[model samples]
Target: MRNVRPWRLVAAWVIVILMATTVPFPSGLIETGPFPFDKVVHFGLYAVLGWTVHRAVRAGGGRRPLSILAAWAVGIAFGALDELHQHLVPGRDPSVADWAADAAGYTAAFLASSVLARKSSRKEQR
Candidate 1:
């Protein structure tokens, strides 16, 4: 893997957070019935956030476990804050299910990254 600047990762994360908080959902866009598409959006957005956090941590010299923990923590906390912010929006309200989806996404991304890292390390060893 090429060397990645930690600050770049941080900047990306900040941009993602800003976008997530500032954007208002269009009416009927997230209201797909029978399948909870909002949850999927929450999951995808926070998964990217978690991946960026993990990359930033790793680039800054954090160990794998620490990076995973930090990614999950930051992702979930940010999700909670996003939900709270949504409550203030005219057409939006806070939902616990969204937060759960965010956490699940973060966990999935973190584990996937961990597995990939382990594989890479093993390949380097061999």
Candidate 2:
């Protein structure tokens, strides 16, 4: 059996994020108090995006350094585009804070992925 293409997985996840952003939410649905839960959701969503992008890059035969850089670029670029796309959605105004959260989430995921990959590679070498 052939392995599923990693880039296809990335595209599917991207579509999911886009579809989710296209929906209009009820008033106060996204924000739930002094601490906006919306940012958490954004962070979590983009975290997965980051992980997928990283895996896709590595699967595509990119070197470790290149995959890390590419994943960060793709994750941040998509986050920015998604923020702009929010302009068309009702009840959603794009905020820089959200983008920052997106970046932070992806950065965290990338670092974690790199560490895990290193460990796995070491195990394989043993």
Candidate 3:
């Protein structure tokens, strides 16, 4: 509430992107799981993006909800764009459904963070 540390926020942003882009599953780590971790990849990425936005807003000494929400929306857009970018790669092709999943994850992350922030605010007021 008092200080907005720029370095810390940017560091978080980098870490989020790095973790999201790196697939540790070796392309065949799971053979027979009912639910593939591929979907989880989308969820975790967007959630981190949402959390990054929230953190950046807090870091910049901004308190308005819209700022964070805007950041989250941008994050979702970036996720979609990134997928499209992947299509240009030799081995990657974009999937609309995956983008939808990314959007869902982004929204879910934003909603969860907003609720948690609101709850924390209430607690601080008490």
Candidate 4:
């Protein structure tokens, strides 16, 4: 893992997301249930994507704020694109709710990472 590159992780994750979104679900595969499990899945996936993008940006010498912004921009833009791409897939319809979940998840992950990093830096200084 020591030699593993952060950008590689980001690219791999991006590919996974792209493949997942590109595939069309079978008809009747997804139903609007009492609870939306798919939103949770979208959130979790975007969270990981956000974290990876943030790490990659930082590893590439981006400053903290810049890294966070880059992660947010990439995550949200990708989410929007994913939603649009779904329109072309059979049995898939774009939803604003799903995009909202993606944005929320990305923001939560990046902010949490930033807070944790600041805390760890303070600890190291002490």
Candidate 5:
């Protein structure tokens, strides 16, 4: 994949930047009081983005399924690390609930990728 397609990199970075801006970063402003949906947001956005980058990098390798799983796993670890970082942030206190939400997001992404791969594989046979 040319070590990294410039456009895909830009896309990924743009996604990351967009997500970073949108997600709550904890300004300690009024304490939204434990967002239940944050974890899902973490997983849903990151997993797809990570999988997209992985697929882009390995497009012709015929190894997308495994790569997608790895992307989700990496995202899980990242979510954990992210939560930890939040703990260190001045306005944010880390919560395991957030991490659980993250996992749920990853699972959702994984299922979505699997479905896509399955349909594509079937198309290839037809």
Candidate 6:
């Protein structure tokens, strides 16, 4: 395992925090659509979070399953907290659907990371 840069992990976490606090939509910036756009946004955001956490953990010398598990745990927990925070915002309300999307994103990322890690290990062994 390569050494994980602490700064990279810190930067990833900072991005997550900024994203959580930033308003979802500003007036007139973008009109709401009939489609479920917010769910897509939640999935994408949590996907990034999961990827970053996975990278951070792998850099710290964690094994494949452990790294993936940690990332998923962190991403899901953060998503829950983010939803809770939105409840306090005047224009926003928490939704379980959003959290489900977040979990799905994290799960997808974790599975992909695990597959890649296994492939890498196989190649290294050859």
lDDT of 1 by residue, 6-80 (tens): 657667766776676567666556767887887887788777766766666666667757656766686678778
Q: After superposition, how far is residue 48 of candidate 6 from its true place, in Å?
A: 1.3
Global lDDT of model 3:
0.66
> Candidate 4 regions off by >4 Å?
1-4
Tell me the alpha-carbon RMSD of every candidate. 3.1, 2.3, 3.8, 2.8, 4.3, 3.3
lDDT of 4 by residue, 34-107 (tens): 66788888899889988877666666666567656866787899899999899999878888988998888887
lDDT of 5 by residue, 20-97 (tens): 634556564443556545555555666665555445534545455576556567667876776676655555676787
Best by lDDT: 2
- Give the per-residue lDDT of model 6 (tens digit) for 15-40: 76556655664532332566577678
TM-score comparison, 1 vs 2, better candidate? 2
| C-alpha lDDT values of all predictions | 0.73, 0.81, 0.66, 0.80, 0.60, 0.69
Instruction: Look at candidate 4 and give me any clashing residue pairs.
Output: none
Q: Estimated TM-score per prediction? A: 0.80, 0.88, 0.70, 0.86, 0.63, 0.76
**Cα error, candidate 1, residue 46 (Å):** 1.2
Model 1 lDDT, residue 53, Cα: 66
Off by over 4 Å in 6: 6-10, 13-17, 24-35, 64-67
What are the clashing pairs of model 6? none
C-alpha RMSD between model 5 and the true structure: 4.3
What is candidate 2's lDDT per residue for 73-116, written digit by digit as tens?
87899899898889889988788988888888887887787778
TM-score of 1: 0.80
